[model samples]
Target: MLCSDLVAHYGLKKSRRVSIQESLGIFLLYLAYGCGNRLVQEFFNHYGEIIHRHFHKVLDVVVNLSKDIIKPNANFNETIPEHILNNPRYYPYFKDCIGAIDRTHVKAYVPQRYQIKYIGRKNYVTQNIMVACDFNMCFTFAWAGWEGSAHDTKIFNEARRRREVKCPLPADGKFYLVDAEYPNKKGYLAPYRGSNIRYHIPDFRRGQTRAVREPKGFKK
Candidate 1:
């Protein structure tokens, strides 16, 4: 049975001017609508300054939690994981593969004056977030705040070059798996391109008959 209580005990203390749920709602609405503080103020019935302060207050809590939640594994530098070593299909071929890198778009809120730059190919405001993770699905590094219009390749290049981002680079012989959209380079391994290559998982699903002359890719 689910508890239907709305004012139930919450971990966060309510501010003098707002309850915990209200504060969270203010932040979430700002994110969901991608609207300015002034616009959010109208919906929440609070002054823009109060809304801005609470919005950032909630954001600070999230930022502090990310310090631990978004870090790499403690033994990240250890030898190749045993699961990979024991898997016959992945062992030798993927011995040097370390992790995976990708990008995602997150809805973003900006002042109306600067919203023009945030519009993306998706036809909405967003932030392009570049991230990398190990096989265990643990995030190792993330570089965000790029305009939604930015291409994945452009964000990747900037993330790698920015010292403050500390975007981890592969060691001498190791590489990170990346999608086809990313460039295939020394440390980033993107699938072999060309229409002949059948890399999409649907192409290899069970019961799908393979034609003898069909182009083969990583799953050949």
Candidate 2:
């Protein structure tokens, strides 16, 4: 039941080499166990003859199919839920916030020569992945393939270079929420620095609390 729904949602079709169900099954198994080829084959109670090769083949097919549709290269826009729109308690920034951005590394074993360049300073051989998530926490953008040594700020700059987010920052001051690894650049906001603590509100308040907090230099 769920498999059919997923296939329809993902718009996957029967490949020339395999059935849609089989491909879906391989993907599910990968997500379930995060196992290597041999381990995945063992989990499926099969030898290397069939399922192992098919798993990778299915992955390649799906990745190619999904490449264009996965990430939308548009600037952030407000698509606030009906309930949240009417609630004064919620921060108005929720509507203006384009997305939350972060980077992570996926560990892998590669050749020594490759690992020399790929392994990060922390000594973990990893592939760096950066992603941007909308207000709903769904990924709207992702970039993978950089080495783990790549910094999150560098990844963001590169993402900008790709011309994906071409829209200008909002005139009324829209911004992005990013981690400490990112700089407090224009069009993006990070936590207030210790040196600049006097300028920012320690905690944003709502409703009557806003009135009490407003006079103390927390006004938006």
Candidate 3:
């Protein structure tokens, strides 16, 4: 059904030699099987070299369509959902929290000269992607395509400036959770420098069998 909808929307008419359905099938198979172009050619033997050309065209159509399909639901005025407000672990402190923000590195390929810009401390080429997700595990914002060597704070500042992924300032005493990598500014809350709980979790797990003790005066 989705494939048919894409065909209609993109006006991907069937060619004299190969039908639209078959062309789409070749593209999906390459993705689903994680196979190379040669392997895909082997699978669709009848289409032969034609699959190679059609593959990129269909891929381009899908990439263009994804801009609308894969964006955050930017509803700033919406109140905290009832489900999050009722949860014991999140009720009081995080009741005002809208979401969590973090960055991760994803492997990427680039030209030799440009590869140096994408290389991070991990000694690999990657794209540093910033993602914001709510308690419901749904993404509220994403800022991607930054160089892997870029700092998280720098990326966050740029995203805010460009309004590319507009993270609305929290109103009515609400806020968003972020790690120490970000500044403890107006709408964003970060953990304390020396007493961050994440730092203690690994050490706590190494020696403990029973309930782990909280770090001195660590607040929930």
Candidate 4:
């Protein structure tokens, strides 16, 4: 469905110069493995000139279609699902929790003048992307294009102010879960701070024999 929409939007038509399938193949290969222009041309067994032209054309199409492709789930309503509500570990305490929000860094290429701004503490150029996922482990919201050096709180504030990402507004005492990096605001909930405090599930499950044992209340 998405491919068809992009093809139609771009007015792409098959011809001896380059078929739509070949164009899509080249685009997917370039993105999937982050191959350089020369490597991609070699893989397709095409001359530098031909591959270079087609690669940029396909990239332009994909970039233009991203607004439609990378959007929030329409069904999201800031309500916790039954599966999460029924789980002993999450229920009661997190009954009002609907989803989790966090940021991840993806390597990026930038001009020399701006490289320092994009270089993070890890000493690499990257883009800090924020994502929010629901209980089903599906992404509900995403905001990309932030500089790697930008703090998580800065990105969240900018996203909220500009509404670049459609994070559902929490109501009826519901809120999205966030890490300590984010503030404990009306729409976001954060764990308590302090040393020796383990609020995450993995923290409690680590090196514990009970985590490997079946629950005593288990039933077929």
Candidate 5:
């Protein structure tokens, strides 16, 4: 399992009071349930400091894993994906396509002075995370730590400039499918922008109906 891999490679050791499994469990619970150290302490019968320390220790290693685990396939340059080659619908047109790219907001709690920069369209504090993934649902690249208010195009532009995570670049004629928010550049594909055409079915239904008893010309 991943916990065992962490022990073997990442330098996380077994504690005197608990094994690596238990310490990792405490951290996972804190994240999964969004509970505090006190709640984890009550469940695991460990001190708050121990809980906090173990959580950070696990986090440190997991972040490091991104360098290896979240990157383009080693064979990406040499061969086309089987998913595209076998599917007649995408075989010819998308043969040069590599993967999909997008961004999302991850909830964040920053210092009060910096909170304004973290407020997203959802009106919540978050960090905008950009990612690219293959058709197999495997993440090929990830770029994180941007403020939530940052635009997707802006984040991608900056992420591509950084050397460490600047990979998964399209080779020659290859491209990755991105949404309308990203530019349809040399190595990226995006749909045409049209205000009259709704991308999703739900978007077309939005604001098209009202209560039958309401006045005909009522706005809002």
Candidate 6:
């Protein structure tokens, strides 16, 4: 099963040949347990001896076969969150906003040289990962492994430059919701400017504050 499908997908080298049963067994074992190479080796010790190197080869075959499994489609399916779609109140400023953008970091074993440039002001070294999560809090896209020193705004701009998320907008106008880090643009709606803008301030309610409050018992 493994050999036949892999050969059909990637076309095996003319010289090297592996039996279908052998490759299929290894792949099935990996899929069944989802264990690392060492664990797989120990588990199947009674059947036969399997090393990390051989296990990695089987993994490569599976990776290569993925292209065939996930064949090309005309329309890409984007998974957005429920809150973004259901609760427009939380995101009143961006009614159509379906995702949130943020950057995170991860540790690396062998960081690239000139690593000082990648270290943030906090002093800990790591990679910056930019993610756009749907309203459901599911990750729709992940942009990671960037130098930590890079700015999230710059990364967001780059993502826009690449035209990654191309959602359709309304006929009248379109806008995005972002934090203070990103600059406001025609299609981008950031929080109000300065401390005087009470709507975005802590403990401030929308359409209700010292400046914008209605008269006593006044009904809108």
Top candidate when judged by lDDT against the true structure: 5
Top TM-score model = 5
- Each candidate's root-mean-square deviation in Å? 8.0, 8.5, 6.0, 8.8, 7.2, 10.2
lDDT of 1 by residue, 112-202 (tens): 9877788888788999888998877778887778899888898888877877567777778888899766878998998755445556577
TM-scores for candidates 1 onward, in order: 0.67, 0.60, 0.71, 0.75, 0.80, 0.49
* Better by TM-score, candidate 6 or 1: 1
Give the Å error, residue 129, model 4: 1.1
Cα RMSD, model 6: 10.2
Instruction: Evaluate residue 212 in candidate 3 and report its C-alpha lDDT on the 0 to 100 scale.
Output: 36
Candidate 1, which segments miss by more than 4 Å at Cα? 1-48, 64-68, 202-220
Instruction: Report, for every candidate in turn, its global Cα lDDT versus the true structure.
Output: 0.75, 0.63, 0.74, 0.74, 0.82, 0.55
Worst 10 residues of 3 by lDDT: 207-216
Q: Which ten residues in a row have the lowest lDDT in candidate 5?
A: 207-216
Query: What would the TM-score be for candidate 2 when compared with the true structure?
Result: 0.60
lDDT of 6 by residue, 56-111 (tens): 56666665555344321222233223564466666554454544556677764344
- Order the candidates by TM-score, highest first: 5, 4, 3, 1, 2, 6
Name the regions of candidate 6 deviating beyond 4 angstroms.
1-93, 163-172, 196-220
1-220: candidate 2 lDDT, tens digit per residue: 6447446554556655667677667777877877667776666665565665667656655655445555534544545543446777755746566666778888866778888767886688998887776655667666777888887778878787776433233334566777667767777887654422332244333222111112224435
What are the per-residue Cα lDDT tens digits for candidate 3 across 1-220?
A: 7578778786566777777888899889977987877787777776456987888778877755654555545564367755577888767766778877888899987889999989987799999998887767877666668999998889888877875445455676778888667877888997765423444366577753333344456777
Candidate 2 lDDT score at position 54: 65
- Cα lDDT of candidate 2 equals 0.63
Model 4 stretches with alpha carbons more than 4 Å out: 9-17, 44-57, 60-73, 164-167, 199-220
